[model samples]
Target: MGNIICSHSLSPLSHSTARCHYLVPTSAYDVFINHRGKDTKQFLASSLYDNLQNRGFRVFLDKSSLRVGQYVPEAITCAIRRAAVHIVILSPNYAESEWCLDELYLLIQTGAPIVPVFWKVRPSEDRMEDENGVYAKDFRKHKKAGKFSTETLEKWRNALRWVSLVEGFISEG
Candidate 1:
């Protein structure tokens, strides 16, 4: 472990919020948030970001870290590469966004420890659905377009555990 860098001690490159799009880590981060733009409401209220930061994990949100006119793929690739853990906020609309799917692929490739937290946005849905229903169409489209791999089920298992962590204990209260 290295000596703690005071907030003022951070060079611009280490700060995720820098104007030049530098990644200065004053401290190591535990999780990187991969979510839909519209799902920010959940992130905000969950206080997950703030809680993680308070616990000393530097969580990066796209709106604050990404710069305008930058290469979207490159930016995300960099962030995912640097992250120690990735948290996929799997809402109904998450897979619908090409960007989030791209991030998922990159995170998989990068082999970052991922925690997929499914936000149960519906009271009716028992299983995943496609664009024709209450969920995003990506999963179904992929299945119909071609045979899918077992890896997807493995990933979903990880996601289910994440959801259980928050929900199981949450409801116990």
Candidate 2:
């Protein structure tokens, strides 16, 4: 990650270690990291967050950026909207979470720059092939679950397709 300079004017506390002050809805973020908690929250996501923060970038990692009493959905949505760039850590179980897919869809809809990190998963795995593919199987499961509407599922598929086409980093290990 090079010098990630966002257009927003930096707040006085932007480089401070006190992260809670930046959780306000009006605060802008340089980076919004999206990932499955079970997959990469403990290690990869946290490491990336640290790296970005250390480099003086205001980053929003759900676990670290969110306050104890804040509304999760609203906070996440606000952060996504205010973020200059998004780093999606696409792990093996990434497509399994509806929340993750929803975030991905929203991020894409924002038309903001997204840096996809293929962590332990190939870009080919996200290609929504009809017969057999990682994302395809996940969507099939979501369809069978009867919770998500067809349109929503299709949107997720489209998001995956679009993101997979973008040039991104690959982390095989």
Q: Highest TM-score: which candidate?
A: 2
- List RMSD in Å for every model shown: 10.7, 9.2
Each candidate's lDDT (Cα)? 0.52, 0.78
Q: Model 1: residues >4 Å from true position, as ranges?
A: 1-28, 41-46, 67-70, 121-133, 136-173
The digit string of per-residue lDDT tens for model 2 on 26-143 reads: 4479999999999999999999999999999999998899888876765676687678999999998998887788778878877889999999877878886545866778888988
Residues 1-173 of candidate 1: C-alpha lDDT, one tens digit per residue: 11111122211112233322353343234577887777654554246677887897777766656668765555555677678888776666665554565566556555667775556553112144323544434556644654434454334334333343443111110
Report the C-alpha displacement of residue 23, candidate 2, in angstroms. 6.6
**Model 1: ten consecutive residues of lowest lDDT:** 3-12
Q: Can you tell me which runs of candidate 2 are displaced by over 4 Å?
A: 1-27
lDDT of 1: 0.52
